[model samples]
Target chain A: MSTQSVAHDQPHASGGKYVQIAVILFVLTALEVALFEVSHEAGPTGFGALLASHFVVILLALSALKFWFVAMFYMHLKFDLKVLRYVFASSLLIAVVVISALFVLFTYNRTLWWATGVWK
Target chain B: MTAAVLDHDSADAHEEHPTSLRIDSRKLAIWTFIGSECLFFAALITTFVIYRNSHATGPGPKDVFEVPLVTAGTAVLLFSSFFVVMALNGAQEGNRKKLLLWLSLTVLCGCFFVGMQVYEFTGFMHKGMGYSTNLFATSFFTLTGFHGTHVAIGTLWLGTLLKDAYKGRIPPNKALNLEIAALYWHFVDVVWIIIFPVVYLMSLFAK
Candidate 1:
């Protein structure tokens, strides 16, 4: 789509604000890359549960930061129509449920992979 | 949320708020669509991350992804977002020439990004990594390839807009449309952020 597609609902003319947001996005990207480069050892048997907990926490934190950026800026959910937010939030909640269910089903049973002894 | 920003130039011209600006309308609808797409991409990312540790055969992420190239591409895509923002500013002020320039710049960046991607994919193939290589390969290709397709689509969209810029058919009133396109572009970039970490960086975690 071109600039002529939407009626200009330009944000506040404060150019600094966008520069600020862009800076934030750039920094976050760097941080994510850095996080991935940093690794930690987890449970072999002794600290297994503790390791899992730590990993889950770290992953959730990174994911949450990404979520906040997209929701706040790109989607304009931060300042614009609040009702529109429910759409994003609701869909995400549903997807999370479905994916989690898939993971649980895979872990708890064997129904999903009626493989050709090869691939799904 | 001032009356001024919402109602800037009340006397300039007024029409029904286009579907673009109306909440939970077109923009929101697209967002919901994107949300689902996020999960779609996320599924691919998660699969790649989980199975990466178990790669029975094929070029894994570390064997392929040239970080310098990808990082530069990332910067290109990010800066393109900025150009689109400038383009929007130009359009709001009714500056077609400047708008066209920035839009073209954004499109150029998209093309460059895609070019880098083609090269990257080719390089990966050269590393003996293909889609059928293994589960990790499947997920890697599906995930990044999916995003690559989006970039290609976005590039085409940008080209069409650029062509319209030349044809002088791009509506002057559709600043929101520029915004919509920019939003989608940025969202695509955002998806890469998630994937870069989950797929490219932690690729060693794949077995």
Candidate 2:
């Protein structure tokens, strides 16, 4: 989404596109930092809890957007062979599953320990 | 005899890869390696996240992270990504001077990023947070240290390529070399993108 026109006769993205993505990334990072500061100061009660939840979701969404931009545009995965995309995506998918499973198991164990007074 | 030898050398330089997929085998290999590296960094990151709040008696993300400083560093890495692609473009176009200029700039940006990490780690250590300080500290250092190491390696790789470019070695036919390096560089930047939010922003606010 850049207005700056780039002249390219190749199959790859132009410099203008990369600059636009970089600007978008910068904006998203700024938003993440701002959300963190606001969340850090939020009170410990009702409205603050709601704000914090929203903050976490938006912060994560911003991160994902940044990741997508870099992976797709900068890495040229968007224009490269589809098989290469699957190779990277499948590995990422497995990583997500493994990490999520571990997080869930750890959270459950923490809850059980807390109930049994196993942790202070 | 000399003309025949010269033609042989140029033909070899412009030789096409004969592959079933009609694509370069070297490119496929780099992508495969990148895929494996994805899982590798994922495991490190997941470990960091799991131990994010497990700092028994050490400083936490909220206390240690300087968002402004890191934002600058992130900008540097992102710009370096852009630079590498531009450098590749120059290489593909066979503009030796353009290739050398952009590659040098990219390498400089990478060095600046590594320097920032060194400063950050030193500051943390001075503040009593070592590798063995706590789970949070250990995981933080490990995840980020590994990334910084990758950036350092990438910088060295590009530097070597820059030397070759200066010697008039990286022509359009050999642009795949720069392309492969660019892919690795972009991957490193993407890892930091994840790390910035997951490790820094999330932890700073999760507290």
Candidate 3:
């Protein structure tokens, strides 16, 4: 409505910060690829073996960090309105829930499908 | 009039009508759309995870995925995300040249990413992993194909914005146009951020 309010709603723009975040994202991505290589080559025998054991967790953590940086900084969720955050987070939460439910259902309870005749 | 004054005037006109939520409706709508997209992609990813190992008689991840190629593509997409943000920053600062330069780079990165995906898909096909070859092939194609489609769409969106900027249509006050496109582009990047690790890397060890 008012110019003052419009200006207040606009998030601060900073190219330097975006560049910094991009560098961080690139580094994280490199780490992910390197971790994968080490784990794959290690073959459960050494330090790479240890990394291989926790590879999924480590990789997912790195990926989530990259996701967070892009969502919060690149997408301006960090500076924009809280409602936007809620909207995205809630949807993401539901997505996570759906993934978890499906994984649990299909992975551990594979028989449930046959038992319920859903596959039939 | 100074760019600052023009920006203020534009913002005021952009929101002359008060919204019930006290924010730009377009921004809110875009965010909502992004949220729904998360669910859509999540479903695709879930199917992939569920069927990741069901290769029956076709090529699997290790057979078809070239990690180095995909890693490079991922880097390009990530950089594009950065480029778009810079473009938005320039637009908001009323720096027309900066906006056009960064936006053009962003579009190029988007195209490159899409091109890389096409190459990867062709490679998969050459490796005998057709869309209906097996469960793994089907789900993998569906998931990554949708992501590539999004990249193409986003590239077109940014290309249009770049054209607009070149034509001097996007002034400091209209930076919201580019900003919205940037948001969508960033969402695509984040989706791949998840897809890369979950679908590509993790699938390497999938039993």
How close is chain B to the truth by TM-score, in each candidate?
Answer: 0.83, 0.91, 0.91
In what order do the candidates fall by TM-score, top score first? Answer: 3, 2, 1
Worst lDDT 10-window in candidate 2 chain B: B1-10
Instruction: Give me candidate 3's TM-score against the actual structure.
Output: 0.90
Candidate 1 lDDT, B75-135, residue by residue in tens: 7877777677677667657688978998999999999999998898888788888878877
List-wise, what DockQ does each model earn?
0.21, 0.35, 0.55
Question: Docking quality tier of candidate 3?
Answer: medium
Residues A85-108, candidate 3, lDDT per residue (tens digit)? Answer: 999999999999977898887787
For model 3, the stretches where C-alpha displacement exceeds 4 angstroms are: A1-8, A112-120, B1-15
Indicate the residue-level lDDT of B160 in model 1: 69
Docking class of predicted structure 2: acceptable
Which window of 10 residues has the lowest lDDT sum in candidate 1 chain B? B1-10
TM-score of chain A of each: 0.60, 0.75, 0.82
Candidate achieving the largest TM-score: 3
Question: For all the candidates, what are their Cα RMSDs to the real structure?
Answer: 8.0, 7.6, 5.6
Q: B160, model 3: CA deviation in Å? A: 0.7
